[model samples]
Target: MPPIAMPPGLKLAQDVMTPAEETELIALIEGSGLAYTPYDKGNTRSSTSYGWKYDYANDSFVPCKPIPEGFRTIAERAAAAAGLSCDDFAECLLNRYEPGAVIQPHLDKPVWEHVVGISLGVPTTMVFREPASGEERPVELSPRSLYVLADDARYVWQHSLPPMQGTRYSITFRTFSAEGLRRLEACPAEI
Candidate 1:
């Protein structure tokens, strides 16, 4: 498939992480002891949320296990590479995609302004669809690469990952909006 045309406010950095860093990050996530849940009711991928998890049942953000320290460095680097502050993000979601797993096209919730994703283990094609025009494009995400979505890319397009041939992992970092933060603070769960 042809690679996607780059959209405004979208940035992709290939081979952003060293092999050693990737290995260490993988080990840290696997050993973190946080339970991985299905991406949704029946999605093939499993994921664990850190810092905050949206409670669909409650329609609010709730606290989850804190992000591991090992991931802090990765987040910092991603922020710096994206021209964002390290403090800009306060949550992360780590997804593990087994072979054949796929994520359907969907826009991220409006609660976050930007998203930074780090790909690991295997390369995969991420598809983006323009909401109004419905034009689709594909972007290859290589192992140890980083991709950032902000502004139009974050709010106007929908993104998805196609079924993979090998296991792959993605760490996505996001910052909560002020209203989201207020809702998080009002959640019954302790932060």
Candidate 2:
């Protein structure tokens, strides 16, 4: 297990969950949504290319859909450890990949109580670069692990997945707003 790294304002815990927990989460997300669209992806005003995001900002987002029993249990524990109530958090932004798929680097826009993610299935490299300086840190996201980015890290540094060279499963957990939820319901995320 890798010690949680607090680089500057960033807080990263590589192995937050057990292996069994990871397997259960993958099944939960993959089985939930039949048709899927691009998530957390975008291109900025500049020429730099970015990847998709699971924008819960829209109303079409299935907030209560993907919260598998096991996942919610884990979230509760992690929240307690962090001294949070968990009730205030938003829904899970689940992302599934076959192979050779990748998400680009970008900062998480503030929307929920915290920015959370869970990794399962085949291991993947999660690279974090200092949002401004470009210094990079690569961490292997293992099964059933919780990755929490809060406070400074959520807005300060940039994190992204390398090309999904091999098939892997991941469910990114995040929080959203009632207003944003209304928007998602009305228009839904284009990505």
Candidate 3:
């Protein structure tokens, strides 16, 4: 295949975790006991959040269950792959995509800075689009691989996933932007 021009500040790292680690994570996620809520245009996809969740009505992130200890090592590794420290991230979103599930094209919320996603289970393609140029780039996300979106890729491009032939899971970590930090400090001590 010819080289593809990826958006600036976008990074992809393969084999971030061993197959055994991936299986352990899947087990942990399955047993987390968190309810999965519908996402995107239709109710085809579902997700659960930890550390923090965006409150659409309030336009701020609210504290949710903290990132579980079981995921600490994975999170630390993901942070290193993104050239950041684990403490830099304040939110973790777990998504479960059943066969035929899809994610509509959209940018990450403005209050977020860097976004890192670890793909697990079945492999799938993530499409990134530059709205101004009407250009779309497709990147394959293999199981256990990780991707990071920062700067232009995180702010200028919109991304989505098409319907998949098999089930997949993603663990996404996000850092707060300057504005997000302010809003986070204003959050109540208890949720």
Best by TM-score: 3
List lDDT for all candidates, in order: 0.81, 0.57, 0.86
The residue-by-residue lDDT of candidate 2 on 43-75, one tens digit each, is 211111111233344524332333446567767
Provide the lowest-lDDT 10-residue window in model 2. Answer: 43-52
True-structure Cα RMSD, model 2: 7.1
Better of 2 and 3 by TM-score: 3
The total number of steric clashes, by the backbone 3 Å criterion, in model 2 comes to: 15
The TM-score of predicted model 2 comes to: 0.68
**Ranking of models by TM-score:** 3, 1, 2
The residue-by-residue lDDT of candidate 1 on 20-59, one tens digit each, is 9999988876765545453365555777788887766668
TM-score of each: 0.90, 0.68, 0.93
- Look at candidate 1 and give me any clashing residue pairs: none
lDDT for residue 149 in candidate 2, whole number 0-100: 75
Highest lDDT, which number?
3
What is residue 42's positional error in candidate 3, in angstroms?
3.5
